[model samples]
Target: MNPEVNEDKSSLYNKVVEGKAQVYFHKTKNEVFYNPIQEFNRDLSISVMNTYSNVNNNKKLKILEALAASGIRSMRYALEIENIEEILANDFDQKAVDLIEENKKLNKVESLVKSNCDDATLLMNSMSRNWKSKFDCIDLDPYGTPAAFLDSAIRAIRSGGLLLITATDAGVLCGNGADTCFTKYGSVSLRTPACHELALRILLQSINSHAARYSKYIVPVLSLSIDFYFRIFVLVYDGQMKAKESINDIGFFHVCPECHTFYQQNYGKTVPTRGNVKFVFDSTSPYDLNKCQNCEGTLKLVGPVWTGKLHDKIFIQHLLKYLNTKTTDDFKTRERMIGMCNLAYEELDNPLYYILDDICSVMHCETPNHNVMRSAIMNCNYQVSYSHCAKNSIKTNAPSEVLWDILKRWVELKPVKEKWMGPEYRLARILKTQPKIQVDFSIRSDCTPESKKNNLLRYQEPPPFWGPGSKPKRKAEDEENSKQQNEKNQKVIEELK
Candidate 1:
């Protein structure tokens, strides 16, 4: 296959990634192209698709890559996955469509993959008009937020079909850009250690809200916050009752600004009731004041986000089993996948997580080993599990006081570090006088084990001089060199002609 020329007269580079799929993309000074960092994202998507197919007994699955730049992801799906009937790789840019077609032929997947040039939302909406034309799976991996495409995507997928959505707007979803998040997602995001988890929930909430408009609801099979983006795989279900019922999962959080204590309150859920017993929900009264019970500090109310389970344990188990059966050259990614799935599988279906570093800092003490903290919490009969959001964080059912008590005990055993002593005078004083609680410091079997090796899958270092922040400028000498190289490539193409 020949390389295509971009509008700037730059020749595209045809390269192979993940040891199998070949992609044609431009890597010039002015062109934006493929990112190697998302290899793990693509890898996980393939695995999820394979597992979903197996579990659902799906055959002849049709997929739509809504934002298929260069068609690498679509091509990868066709080449790597089984039981794929067809893949429509669509991009708004004609240049991208040309590259997608070239890559499709290069991979010899012309029969299985089709390339289209159209606005993603328009294409999906048009396809949704036909009852039989909806795809079995629609992958919306846009460059930024996927919110704009969620409505069309939901309409374009068949009932019980999978919708794989990627949101790279971490800043907005993770609370860095709170106003933007609320404006786009209709939810407030908390800037806390557990913000990544919140980010996943916020995205899900957005998807759920959009689906509800069409009397459809989503069941999140797996949700991941990896690197600079969040990916969620959900199965769409159609039913007015089910859609309305799913609204119970949408709620807001009251988070303490001082101590980071947070709690969720679901909308239309007022009084507590027994199992299988229905109670009248009072919508007239407002939710209790956003006040911290522990610190008496005014809590910051954030969200109207998804308060349901992020990952289906059964689905993750199936994914792990699927991973066990497969082998790949990207061992790092595979290992990280295993580790992350394990963590996600066991994580408490809790809303927010407590960062050990933050907890220790609050107590004016050196951070104890995570295992030690886990053991301390578990000794108190509180369930504790590792968080995928942060390394030193744990999702637990323990109350704030209990966690602080554990930290207090640790400080008594090992006095606060000198540097940490002066600023937190109140904490230091309390720690020095607080009675030591007798708790076994031994690591418990339930404590999450540290990965034996580094998992570089989540965040991979970008190639030198490649990033959105700073573009590499061509030097006076490098410009001449690039011009000569372009001329040489053009001459080669002419010779072939």
Candidate 2:
């Protein structure tokens, strides 16, 4: 036979007769369907499994994969992870279920995998009643939004269950379709340069919000951008208040134009800047800045941008505590986990505020209300305020994601900064003179003697009112004007009386 013909025949046999894909991944061998995309996902799934194995305490784990396209991820988890005690794998397609059964037997994991053909939503609803506290981990790797199946997935996951979610619609979360994002995900999108990081934060917050309905606390253990998708590994611990607190950690960006600098603050703390400084209180918005501070030249905002740090050193340390355990089997898996843990620990700090703000803004715009945006702005360690109309021009002279990048010099504002006594004192003096600005001073807090004295010295406070004797009376021309005013008042009083 000709060499070319022979090669073609072999390729045909491997694909058609032998039932194999391009890559022969461990625990993924079977007699049927294959996909390279699924292959990559399986690799990721196995890594997660190996990590779970290190922490399993020999307890029975119930794992459910809602949408098993080729049963690749389910198959790998079932066959490889020793810690996985039981799995209930479901696929809506009957043919897919058949392949799942075959793969189960081929991998000798049939005893562990219980394959079924049913809509994931239906299965999740049915499981809600009987499967309460049943599953130890629930993985949802869907084709797109995962929004249609999200409520059910939230319900199916056992409290304290691991919910591994993957969102492939990067464009939507990254601010391409701001309206759609708000409509579907209940959030807004701000396309900043650090858009990917913003994408992750928005996704995490959306997941947290969705999970909150089921009384779950989602602690993000791992988050990464992979294969045109965003994946997050969150541990769903049981707690109402803790979950509320977790959701409240979202932050916002306040951009400043004067200094070509943006002020980033959170929602939870007091609003740092005043409401009106020459008719504009915020001096910032969620948008990017146009000018450079130092040279006045327009600068660029480059991103994948993460404003907060990626990981907590203490959290990384806690994860590493399980590294030397005997339960973990694969060296490669161990290395990946350790690397992720370290990156999260070492690089994660400052909470990625720039990215967090954009994320929340994107998500906020997507949602029907400003709840998520408000929550994020309300709870951050700093302060944030909302605007009804565009306060500044949206046109940025620099890269759209410029502010998404970390500032060259970050001034950590002191928590105990003094209040703005200048404005308050000026207003107080004005109130004393006019007394009829229709303003109320009862809401104003008393200033310290030193603060009051300082304002007096700084020319911030107007001179105090003095008796008429302290200054010459009005001039003859002014007296004539006063007499005319008195005559007018007498006429109006006489008419009323």
State the weakest 10-residue window (summed lDDT) of model 2. 405-414
What TM-score fits each model? 0.84, 0.55
Question: Per-residue lDDT for 1-497 in model 2, tens only?
Answer: 11332233334223211112121211223323344433334554555555554555545568888887557667667755668777888888765676566556556777888887899999887887755535777778776676677777777777756777778777887778867777667766556544555677667667777777767767766676543666777766668766555533555543322222333433342232566312123323344345433223344332212233333345345456655452324333344444434434433233332233332232121221223322322232222221101111121222322321111101111121233224343222211222111211121122112212333211112124311111112254477799999999999999999
Relative to the true structure, candidate 2 reaches a TM of: 0.55
Each model's RMSD to truth, in Å?
Answer: 8.2, 26.5
Candidate 1 lDDT (Cα, 0 to 1): 0.78
Best by TM-score: 1
Taking all chains together, the TM-score of candidate 1 against the true structure is 0.84
RMSD of 2: 26.5
Q: Which ten residues in a row have the lowest lDDT in candidate 1?
A: 465-474
Q: Any idea how many clashes model 2 has? A: 41
